[model samples]
Each structure stands twice: as C-alpha cells, then as structure tokens.
Target: MSTEESPVEREDRWVLNLRGMSVTKITVDFRLMLFLDSDWEVAFDASVDLSYGTAHANPSVLLSPESQGVAGALALFGANVVSAVAFKSGTLRLVFDNGHHLTCSPDPSFEAWQVTGPRRWHFASLPGGDLAVWTGSGASES
Candidate 1:
C-alpha cells in the first residue's frame, strides 16, 4: 500500500510531541517502539543533545533492540524526532526533562495506553547524565 493510503487501513497509531524546557541546553534519552502490524515490531534508544539555537538535536550513538536496526528506520521515515512516543493502541505521551508528563489515550478509536515514571534522572548536570523514558501499550493480538 502507498504511504498516503496506509493510515486509512491501519486501525491504530499516534503522534507525540516532547518539548524541552527553556533551559539553554539539555540532553534527553529516548526510547521508542514502532508497532508495525501484529508480528512486526521495532525499538529505538538514543541520547539526543539540544541547544537553544536549534530545534533538532545531534543524536549520539546508543543501543537499539531491533533486527533491522534504528538507522534504517529513521532513514525510512525521515524522522528527526525531537521528542515523540507512539504506541500501537494510538496513545501518545510527551514528557519533559523536569519530570513533567502528559498523556493522551482515547477509547476504541485508537489511543489506548499509559506512561509512568520519571523515577529518577541520573546526571542532571552534564551531557553524560543518565536520562530515560518508557512507553507501554496493549499487544496487537491481545
């Protein structure tokens, strides 16, 4: 199916927008899961550094747990994701570096899931500080 037509056939999806605080500089660790169909799935993890001057961050090499790899997927979607969290159930969550969080999950018309925790931020000072986020959704077949 064409890209334009794909959304019509897909029953669930979401778009997330994560914005950085007004701080001059900050780094965020991102983890995303791409739920493609029932059996196909992908995950991405990376550390992104952003500054006041630019919207897109310079991403650093991290770990990705997917058979095809994160690079390929990013290339495919042309996603320079500033911040986003998408789930199969169409739920989207956006969290800030300061532990503030927002979530959107509707009823049967897609958008069903949850996001929890800032639990703790390790570094909080340097660029190497530990940052993490999570997203959980219902299984496709479930």
Candidate 2:
C-alpha cells in the first residue's frame, strides 16, 4: 500500500450560505452543530449567539429538547436534514430526521437557548453570507 494523504474539503466561513444544505448529521451540546461531511463542520455556539427570537411550530423536528437529554447529550442525533428557509421575522424552517418539519423563532426573553442555549437554524449565502441559530436550552414545551 502506498502512503498518501487526501485533501480535506472545507467551506470558507466568509463565503458559506447554509440554505438548501443536505446535512449528514447533527449533535446537541454547547452548540447545535452540523457536519456537512466528515471533514466540514459548522455550528451555532450559544456563547456568541446574535439571534434570540426562537419559536417552535412543532417539537418533533430539530428543536426536540425532549429527545436531546442534557444529562446524556451525546446520544442525540439527526440524519437526512434539509436546511429549509429563513424569514426576516427570525423564523427558520427545517426538516429533520423522520420527516419532522419545524419553524424556529428565537426570542431573547424565552430563556433563549445558546450552545451557550443553541440550535443551527439557518445560514444564508447572500451578499454578505449569514448564519443563524436557535436556543437549545428552552425548547417550547407546548
């Protein structure tokens, strides 16, 4: 066997727009993290969160805190994800494992989650590409 190294593909943060992305996996922890591939990763770290108007239209989707146990967060997982859409109102739409579709609106007063209480909501690749996250801490119980 020949010894060789393959290049790792990475997206430039300065030019990435996460909309319409086909996410392979997701993990819940200090951040709502997404793995574009084995080597490309992006996340919504709550510590530096800028958006906080999180609202949940459905709980079964990516915003399922009931499914992500804080005591044992490592077990949390997501497969076959669709990055969906983002609205100026701060609502982000997504499709998670098992075809769960949800819209999240991050409100700072809702005990607003960040990885710091956070979730990977949407990333828009526009004139000045943008990224958004929702709180993973206070998922709507209703």
- Highest lDDT against the true fold, candidate: 2
Q: Model 1, clash count?
A: 1
Candidate 1 regions with alpha-carbon error over 4 angstroms: 1-82, 109-142
lDDT of 2 by residue, 1-142 (tens): 1021221113422112333334566666644655653344544332211111233533232344433433222222443434434443333444444444433445443322221111332232212223233333332211
Q: What is the RMSD, in Å, between candidate 1 and the native fold over all Cα? A: 16.5
TM-score of predicted model 1?
Answer: 0.22
Error of 2 at 98 (Å): 4.0
> Against the hidden reference, what TM-scores do the models get?
0.22, 0.36
User: Where in model 2 is the C-alpha error above 4 Å?
Assistant: 1-21, 37-78, 109-142
After superposition on all CA atoms, how large is the RMSD of candidate 2?
Answer: 13.0
Clashing pairs in 1: 90-111
lDDT of 1 at 96: 37
